[model samples]
Target: MIEFKNLVKRFGTRTVLNGLNLEIREGEIIFVLGTSGTGKSVLLKNIVGLLKPDEGEIWIDGEEVSQFTEDQYFPIRKKCGMVFQHPALFDSLTIYENVAFGLRRHFQLSEDEIKARVGKALNLVHIQGVEEKRPAQISYGMQKRVSLARTIALQPKILLFDEPTTGLDPVTTTAVNQLIQDLSKKLRTTSIVVSHDMNCALSIADRIVVLDKGQIVALGTPDELKRSTHPLVKDFLEEVLHA
Candidate 1:
């Protein structure tokens, strides 16, 4: 339910997104794969209206949002929930407070409603019994789960994940990948995950989009990508397989 048409973003002499044309279907999990500096995160930012495109348009739910002002973009932003590479949780706030932060800012709800939503969000991420603890008191994986919980609590229509499995052990990476898959299936939230992790993409993607030099190099199912002959796609897959 999102479409990008001839999208372009430039910073000085460097062009990050060059005529990007993509369509993300509703309830589909798309994994964007690329090396560093390939505009994967830029794509996410553009989709969320954090960074505006220099040319072309971005459409969400059939509405063009490229020219929307901050006031007009507020509701669109709320419909999207982003999970950064880092959890970005507040060290000073307890887990429950952190998860409740957005809900409090955006909506006026009774304490009981807030508690139930927070509890359900945590359960969705398979996190439990840490509501009273601070972020520092939890493991890195748990902290990531809390970050996800906070986002899911908003009941967003779109979920943007940037490097969701970064900086974790293999076991935790597996857990996080599985969590992404589970959440996408259960929530049906049009998830777009930006990651270079081949295993993660293969494990979770309904389709994989490969970016290179500010452009889409390939887009296909995991099996199709595995059989691709494009030089860049082949090289990238080889590197991931060997690394």
Candidate 2:
């Protein structure tokens, strides 16, 4: 459903992503694993046109969008829903309003339709009640779920996650990982997750792509990665094993 060819991104003297190439299949969960500054988040941003590639092409659903203007990229962004590292929910908006915000803005739906979508999205994330409460009232994990509820309520065909479990405790991280897998399967949307957790990736991802210096160093299923001999892949595996 998504492909990147010879991709490159730079900031003045620094090249973050270099000659990166990969493909994400439809309805599959693909985890991108790398240490800090390996261009994980940059990769996600490039997909939704938050950042443009300097040298390569980005193809989504067969359309090359490396140079699409902001207005022209609107439809592409509508087809992709990105969950940022921060929940970034409005403090004043109630949970329902927060979830319904995108629906109201991007779509022309009645109050009843909005309510139905809000309910279904919250239900998918296993969040119940608290519709009238604000972001400050809920637990952080629930807040994150509400954020996810807000994104999925728009019903995008592709889901992009940038460090979805960044600050969570281990249990919450596991729960969030499971939720990603479940949502991808249930909604039949292709998922691209930029994360640092290899253990969770092993248990949940259809494929894992390991990046080093903005290039793919290892790409395989969990079992295939277990036998990888690359130093970076081994380093990641060591951390996972010793954890």
Candidate 3:
């Protein structure tokens, strides 16, 4: 469903992605694993057109989006939804409003339609009865669920999660991971998750892509990654396991 061909991105003198090539199939849950500053999030942004590549191509569902103009990119973007490390909820807006925000911007739906979709999304994330509360009124974990609901409400064909389990307690982290797994299966969306959380990656990924510096160094199933002999991959596994 997504392909990156010789993708390169640089910031002034620094290169973040160097000839990165990858293909993500439909209904697959892909986890991008790497240390900090390894361009995992940069890759996600490129896929959704938030950051245009300095060189190479980005194709989504068979169309090259690398050279798409902003107006041209709009519809392409609508096929995808992103959740940041920080939930970034509008504090003034109620949970209902927050989830409904994207729908309001992108579609002409009635109050009843919006409410039904928002409720369904919240339900998909196992959240309920907090529709009237502001973001600040909820626990941080709930805030993350709200963020996921917001994205799910858009009915996107693809979901990009940047550290979905970050900044949560262990139990909450597990909850978030399960939610990602469940939603991916339930929604059957092609999902790409950018995370350094090894446990989360292991539990949720159908395939794992390991990045080092600015390029892909490994790609495998969880079992294959566990049995990997590559130095960087072994070191990463050892570090996370011992942490």
- Per TM-score, the best of the predicted structures is 2
Candidate 3 lDDT, tens digit per residue, 78-158? 999999999999999999999999999999999999999999999999899999999999999999999999999999999
lDDT of 1 at 95: 100
TM-score of each: 0.98, 0.99, 0.97
lDDT of 2: 0.94
Error of 2 at 158 (Å): 0.4
CA shift at 54, candidate 3, in angstroms? 1.5
Give the Å error, residue 149, model 3.
Answer: 0.3
Q: Which stretches of candidate 3 lie over 4 Å from their true place?
A: none
What is candidate 2's lDDT per residue for 1-243, written digit by digit as tens?
A: 999999999989899999999999989999999999999999999999999999999999989999999999999999999898889999999999999999999999999999999999999999998999999999898898999999999999999999999899999999998899999999999999998988988989999999999999999999999999999889888998899
TM-score of 3: 0.97
Model 3 global lDDT (CA atoms, 0 to 1): 0.93
Residue pairs clashing in model 1 are none
Model 1: lowest-lDDT 10 consecutive positions: 234-243
**Model 1: per-residue Cα lDDT over 128-177, one tens digit each:** 89999999999999999999999999999999999988999999999988
lDDT of 3 at 10: 97
